[model samples]
Target: MNKAQRLLHILMTMQAHRKFNLKELTEEFGVSKRTILRDLQELSELGVPLYSELGVHGGYQLLRDRMLPPIHFSDKEAVALFLVAESLKGYPMLPFEAEVESALKKFYHYSPPSTKEKIEKLRSHVLFHVQERGLDTPYLTSLLEASLEGRIVTITYEAEKGTSERDIQPIGVYTASGLWYCPAYCFRSREPRLFRADRITALKIVEDQSRRIDPPGYDLRDWFTGRPSGETAELVIHLTRAGAVRAKSDPLLAEGLTVHADGRGCVRRAAAISDLSCLADTLLGYGAKAEVEAPALLREMLLQRVNEIRELYAGAGG
Candidate 1:
C-alpha cells in the first residue's frame, strides 16, 4: 500500500482502539516505531484530534467526540483531485505545503476503495521526478497572497550575475519544466520580468496599492506552445529510447517530438526554449541518451559540457 493507504489504515485503527501505543501500532503495521510516529504527526497536522500520554501505561487516544463528519467525493472528482496532486510531485517547497498535503491525504482517505486502487495502479505504472535546484522559496505563500490582493512586495533576489533588491507588482506565478517562476512587473525596471521563486532570498509585503498599474497580459500557454520571449534557435535532437521516454512529460523537451515507426524518435524543439542555460541543463540531464542533431553552436556546447563532466568524474574510484 502507498503512504496514503497506510495513513488511512492508521486512522481507522486509532478510531477503533482507545489506547493504542506506538509499539502496538508499529507491530500491527509491521513498520518501524519512527514510521508510526510520523504517521501520527501527519495525522495531527491534518487536524486529527489525537492526544498522547506519557509512560508505558499511557498511549495515544483519538478524540472521537470531536471528530469531523466524513467527507464524500464522487468517483470522478476523487480521481481528478488525485491527478492534480500527482502533477505537483516535484514542485520544491510549495507554499502552505502542510495544508496542501493534509488536503491530499484526506482526499485519499475519503476516496472509495475501488477509486483508490485505480489511482494506485496508475501511479505505480508511471514515474515522474525532478531534482530540486540549488535554491528554495519558503515565502511563496506570502507572495501569492500579495499578488491576489494587489499589494506591492519587496524582494531580494539572486540571479546568475549577482544579487539585487526590488519592489514589484506581482502579476502571476507559474511552473515551467520543473521550476517555479513569478512573472511580475518590476517597479525599478518598468518591465515584466520572470523571477525564479527559489532565487527570492527575502520577501516583504508592502502596503496595499491604490493605483495599481495593470501588468501587461502574460500567458504561460504561449510559452508552452513554443513561443518564447527572446532570442531562440531552431535546433533538433535525436532521442535514444530513454530520452524519448523522459521527454513525454517535459514541457519543452516534449514539444515537436516525432517518433518514427522503427521505435526511433527525435525532438525538434530548440525554438521552444527562452533560456539557453535551461535548455543546456535539460540536455545535460539526459546525458548521452539525447543527441543534439542540429544547430552547430548548441551541439558543440553540449559536447564540450559532456566532455568536461566526463573528465571530472573519470578518475573517481581509481
Candidate 2:
C-alpha cells in the first residue's frame, strides 16, 4: 500500500486496538520496526493523540479523544450536511461554536470543486432567517453541561421582579425564536420553571452529593411536545382576516388557530393560567383586529395594560 493509505489504515487500527507495541504493527504490516516508528511519528505530527509507555509491559496507547475513522459521504449527503451546519449560523450563540466552525472548514476544504461551487451558490440562495438577539447568554454552555450531567446548579438570575440566587436541576436547554431557555426544577419555587438563559448572570455547579435529587420523569422533549401541562383554562379569541394573517406570524398562537370559510379565524385552545398575561400582551398588539371572546381574566389584564398606557400618555397629547 502507498504511504498515505498505510498511514490511514494504521490510524484506524490504533483506534481499535488502543494499546499496541511497535513490534505488533511491524509484524502485522510486514514492515521494519523503523518504518513503523516513522509512521507513528507522522501520526503524532498529524495531531493524533498517541503516547508511549516504558518497560516491557507497556507499548503505545491512543488517548480517549482520538479522531474517528474516515467515512465517505455521497455528494448529496455532503451538501445536506453543509446546509444543516449553515442553518446553525442564524443563532447568536452556540455551545461549541469553535468546533462547528472547524468542522465546516474541513468539509469545505475537502469537498470537490463542483461541490464547493454548489455550496457557495446555495449559501447565497438558501437562508434560515432568525431574528437577531442582542442579549448575551454566556452561561449557555454551563447550563447545557449541567443538564446532561443531571447536576444541580446555583445561578444568579435577573427576573422581571428582581435578581436572586436559586438552585435548580435543569432538564435541558433549548433555543426558541432567538433566545435560549432552560427548563429546570427550581428548589426555591418547588416547581418546574423556564428560565431565560441570557438572564442568568452567574452560575456554578453544585457538587454536594447531598443536594442532588432524583431527576424528574419529564424532559425537554416532553415540555416542547405537550406544554401547558398544569391546570389550564380554555381561551377563545375571535380574529379578523388581517388578525388571522398576523397571528400566523406568532409561533405560540398560530398552532391553535383555526381559519373559517371566509378568511376570519379563531384561536381556541386551553392555555395554562400562568400564560394568560403573556397572551394578553400578544393579543393587545393586534388592537382592533382581535377580540377576546372568552376568559374574562385575559380581558381584564388587557384592559389594565391599556389603562396604564393611557395614563402614561394621558396629558401628553394636550
Q: Which candidate is the best by lDDT?
A: 2
- Stretches of candidate 1 exceeding 4 Å from the true structure: 1-92, 98-135, 146-154, 166-171, 175-179, 183-194, 205-219, 269-274, 293-297, 314-318
lDDT of 1 at 108: 77
Clashing pairs in 2: none
| Residue 266 in candidate 1, Cα distance off native in Å | 3.1
For candidate 1, report its TM-score.
0.54
Q: Write the per-residue lDDT of candidate 1 for residues 107-153, one digit (tens) a residue.
A: 77667789999899868876667666756778788777767766789
Report clashes for each candidate as comma-separated counts. 0, 0
Query: Model 2, range 7-113, lDDT digits (tens) per residue?
Result: 87898898888899988898888899999999999778656789899998999999986577667788888889989988888998988777778767766876788
> In model 2, what is the error at residue 85, expressed in angstroms?
0.8
Error of 1 at 130 (Å): 6.9
